[model samples]
Target: MKLSRATGTIATLALAVGLTAACGNGGADAGPAAPVSMDEEITLTFAWWGNDDRAARYEKAIDAFEEKYPNITVQTQFQSWDDYWTARSTEAAGSALPDVVQMDAGYVRQYGATGQLAELDGQVGVNLDTDGVDETALASGQIEGRTYAVPVSLNTQSIIYNATLLEELGMEPPADGYTWDDLVQWFADVAEAGAEHDPQVYPVGDMTGNNPWFLQWLVQQGKAPFTDDGQIAFTEEDVQAWADLWAPLRESQAFFPAKRAAQLEPKTGLNSAEVVAEANWDTLMPNYTAELGSDDLELMPIPTGDDGKKMYWHSGVMLSASASSAHPDAAAAFIDFMTNDPQVGEIFGTSKGVPATDAQKDAMTIEEGSPDARLLAYEDARADDVTEPAPVPVEGYGEIEVEMARLSEEMQYGNLDEDQFASQWFAYVQDTVKAE
Candidate 1:
């Protein structure tokens, strides 16, 4: 069921549209999408969250898009993750979001339900061709039977390790079918093996503070984080259980110290070589390899649970058009080009993530022993392991995730115990979700 919200957050747009129970053609009568005229020239504003490398890739893609459609011009801008949200939220308040924007699955429901995003189903057959896309990946962009965004790529959580470190310690990588207890023992082994090294090499980075990993843990336990209607399905006890899972690592100093982690701003144990392993998205292997200046990194899914391992395919990145934009058709056409163009696949490679469409995937040239090849090989081997459906984050999910991270940081600092963390997080969820 679609929900109506009365919160004053940017998602509501201050226009009192209140949250229309549905966002796309399935819920609201927003009329048909505006038609584009090939004869007339149009300019579109596009924005995204990323570093310079991603910006450069988007630039190339946009250039190709404009070359194909001479009448359409795209002006682009980008920012770091936090800044991107801040700027977009400000723009959302005035109903002035860019014509085209990079979207996160967590924020899609909030923006779509508030009338800030266009209903994309109207453009599907006309301007967008999804025939080459994965059905599961495409479905991830919909909520309440409405399509508000299009997934550009898909990814899943993985534990990436520095093979070089393992080699230096004369240790072998964790074998397949390793359980969570085995992983903890592995951390202890790494610590003991590297005890006499110049700079102490820890076993793993702290993943306890990451919201997505927590959700992944819940899913692995056969617990869905949210209901189909976008309400919280996990309870406070669930949160506590997640916290407890990592207590031994925290107590035994198996992970990189939180202080040291903070000192290495914008860098992580996997990237900086400060620790042997870290749990993150599989798509980040390239970045980690680049940062570590080594090609000896490896990746695998998180350790197994009682019933065996479970994971969900995630829409790593997505695109959405602003409902208030003057050039809806042009916006959608560009999105379609990005989604279906083989050249886009080549230009982006797996930098943005593994492409969501077969055409794009076919376009990639995965050289042997390359990071791209390894990432693809890993996914292919574990495709069947993804047994759960992708999550549809509830309204205010972005804010809730941020709060989760904050409380986790406090817990890391010894300011909040597991009980306090659960209580505070549930309280924040109540106010935030209730307000929405």
Candidate 2:
């Protein structure tokens, strides 16, 4: 049976440490990992950030793990994206973090460099196995040379669309090799065709403030997004260019209305069916399916840029253990089971994204014509398009992106123009991304 506990508020003192605070030689020292073992009874605390569906999936997988190794019991808890980080930062201050955490690439540098996360390389052959995993995807969990986490799945940027709406309008998804200009024109076409519908549909959401898309755009133009020392590498001119790219859509109001979008809190345009298409990760198909109450959503490759197809496969999410865990052996063993087990792939399917290892991919039984099958096929079709290594974000990267998102919403609400948005964003970056 699964073990769980009620979530509680972290100490107010711990909250002052903020999300960027590093543990100062606390009990959770980063060194000398424990050897793998399951000889004695042990209980581990596991935490992740997600909705009810994801919680259920983890419970099912943990049930299998517990069945095999009855000696180890995992007590679990979870929170939303913002709350998860808040709690983690507080726990880090007290060196009381859960044994295992679901890590995001943006905060890996902050956690790993601060010694909050355990290096898993020592436990690889003994307990954790790396066989059949993609080298680049695995490397994303590392900083410099030490392995701090393991990627659970891989994802790439995709233009997700309402296939049912497109078919009803007799419209087609963007073709392969479609350019940025082509995408803009297609948006106009979609807006026109979808006008006569009962609920009314728009082309897409305005993603000009999206930081990842900005990085992709820079790479497509043969520019590096960050320096070796983790400082901002793009210019204010670059930011303005990105903002200007969507000027026509903003002017014509082709995007879903900002006021209307605000009402659909905790959901996106695609989730609420407010728009026909959106730029998002490929793994979101199942979530969209559940939200819209339809299995008609589909994924298409991101629009090609002037420099050709230069998209990179992102480590969608990762599993990492706390350095302070009393039961490191049990922690690593559970992580191994989650990452490499074929049964886990069947249980999770593409809800977390495509499995990161060949073993997990091969083990999953893809039902014909289902979202799981299409998700795998989508990744398989993009093998040649993944050219660059996934970008490892710098410390405070989370704050930077969150600020960008806030400013983008202001821009959409007519509080700031493109030039003002670029100016204010660069100013914030100056104060945010600093040397430690």
Q: List runs of model 2 lying over 4 Å from the truth.
A: 1-35, 168-170, 195-199, 305-307
User: Candidate 2, 291: how far from true, in Å?
Assistant: 1.7
Q: Per-residue CA lDDT of candidate 2, range 1-436, in tens?
A: 4334333345532332222124333123534455555576666677788999999989999989988888777767788989899889878777667778899877888888888888888778877887766776776788886788888888988888988888877799877888888888888888888887777888787878778888877878878787645677888898899899888888888888888888887788887887888888888887788888888899988877565688888888799988777666667888899999998988887778888887888888777988877888888998888787677777888778889889989999999999999999988887787644
Worst 10 residues of 2 by lDDT: 17-26
Name the regions of candidate 1 deviating beyond 4 angstroms: 1-30, 33-36, 196-198
* lDDT over C-alpha atoms for residue 255 of model 1: 71
- Tens-digit lDDT track of model 1 for 1-436: 2122111333333232222112222123445655566777766777788988887888888879877887887766777889788878888876677778899988888888788888888888888877776666666778877888899988988888888888899998778878777877888888888776667788886657788888887877788888778788999888888788778877776777788888898888668887888888899998789888989789877876577668777888999988876667888899999999999999999988999887998898889899989999888887877777677889988888889888877888889888898889988988888898
Q: For model 1, how big is the CA root-mean-square deviation? A: 6.6
lDDT of the structure predicted as candidate 2: 0.79
Residue 307 displacement in candidate 1 (angstroms): 3.7
